[model samples]
Target: MRARLDAESRAAGFVSTGVCRPDAVPDIAAHLSTFVDAGRHGQMAWMAERMAWRGDPAALWPEARSVVMLAHSYAPQHDPLSDLDRREQGAISVYAQGRDYHDVVKKALKRVARWMVAEAGCEVKVFVDTAPVMEKPLAQAAGLGWQGKHTNLLSRKFGNWVFLGAIFTTLELEVDAPEAEHCGSCRKCLDICPTDAFPAPFQLDARRCISYLTIEHRGPVDADLRPALGNRIYGCDDCLAVCPWNKFAVEASDMRYHGPHRAPDLADLAQLDDAGFRARFSGSPIKRIGRDRMVRNVCYAIGNSGAAHLKPVVQDLCEDDDATVADAARWAVERL
Candidate 1:
């Protein structure tokens, strides 16, 4: 039954999996404290709560006997660097360009979890990013991939483009051995960060991370960092894009992950109203940020676009009811 699930995941394009023993839950808890104590998670205050449960999978769901970690590759089809020079266009991270990964990955995980339950007659629970599960650490311990210096997991087969998810079951499936660090002396992902988001190897400061600012941050972005954002209106991909190991990566298997909307125009995004934004980003992760935060992002792009014609767009945004959008729009207007 485990072999069948492995085959199914392999056929679906995931290259890694591992079953971590329930005892290893303590190791995950200990590592998580190091991250939280160091203040690397930024304003994600929830990480500080329920420390005991989040660190150990056994505590999260005492019924679980094994964890089946899964990774899906969403590597970009074309060179991401090509879009860097197109200042007037928005460069969304490849993962967020199409359907929300949580929806795609969760549906697939349910199938695998069901297969396990049928074979063993045991309970199962699946988790993606939404849960407090330390997926990267668990995946690393389970041998899905080594957590690279940028603190994101990197697979030998998929490089830095793999999206991680997990399924915990009461069934005791065969566990795979953990993988060893393969990063060696490479520091490209660290050196390429525009905001220097990484505080040290394998640790990230979310406040300086464009992905956090654009997606997780609720209000006005730091005025100082707006110019550094460049034209990346969505999640920033500089760290993932700069990884040298990505040369071995393959295009995504899911067709929903590809198409023209993969890269949208900055000017067009700036013009999206609440209704338009809702219709355009429906079923995509971008929709979760809502039109206001997205417009706040587009305003930053307009500032970096260097197109005087976009000045009107910024001016309009300055009058927006949301203080966050209006604040960003004023900053953008000044820059343009």
Candidate 2:
């Protein structure tokens, strides 16, 4: 079953797959502990509290003997960076431009897990960004890819376009050799960031990240970073899109991962009220951020849009009860 799944994954455009013992992650956890100790996670304090346990997968689940790391390719039909020059339009990350990946990836992992459990006779647990799993390191250990200088998992075949997920099981499976790092002397990901999110190579300062500020931070963006955000409404992919290795990636196989709905027009996005917002983002990850945060992001895009005509919409949002909404609205009005 394990061999079959690896073959299926490879045929589906996954560059690699490997079974690694849960213990394979202890060294990774120890290193990540150092990253947290150095205060690299910024305001995401959860990374600090789990310091002891986060460093080891065995500590995370004692019963798990093996972990199956999986990768799904989401190569964009066009260069995501190409739209950045259109300041009047928003540049949403390629992954978020489709159906929420949590739903899409998890469904695939579950199917694979069910097949494995039935054939191998063991308990199985699956995760795709919803748990305490150290996905990047585990993927590296599983030989799925190597950690790039930007600290994201990258592969020779897919480059940085793969989305990772994992399944941990009680059955001990054959493990594969870990991948070697291929980011020799490359600092492109660090240099291309508009907000200077990377403090140094391989270490990210989440607070300065446009993705963190626009999507995760629940308040007004730093006035200095607002202009750099341009019209990116949901999340920033400037760094990911610019990686030179992406040239090897093929276009996404899933039609849902393609087309304009994922990259909706910024002007249309700014007009969404609560109901409109929910309806527009029905099954995508953007819906999980709620109307307030989504609007907060939209207002930043409006400000960056230099679309003075949106002054009325910005003014109306000023009365929004959410402090984050009010603050962003004020910023948009000033920019307009």
Best by TM-score: 1
TM-score of 1: 0.95
- Listed in order, each prediction's TM-score against the native is 0.95, 0.92
The true-versus-predicted C-alpha distance at residue 286 of model 2, in Å, is 0.7
Largest lDDT belongs to which candidate?
A: 1
User: How well is each residue in 145-187 modelled by candidate 1, as lDDT tens digits?
Assistant: 7889988988777788878888888888888888888889989
Name model 2 segments beyond 4 Å from true.
Answer: 10-15
Per-residue CA lDDT of candidate 2, range 1-336, in tens? 667878766654445577888887667766786777776676677778776666777777799998989888888877788777776667787887877778777777887787777787899998898777889988988888888877788887778887888888898888888899888888889999998888788887788888887777776788899888887887877788778888777556566665355456666776677899888788877777788887788788888777788788788888788888888888999998
Residue range with the least summed lDDT across 10 consecutive positions in model 2: 253-262
lDDT of each: 0.82, 0.79
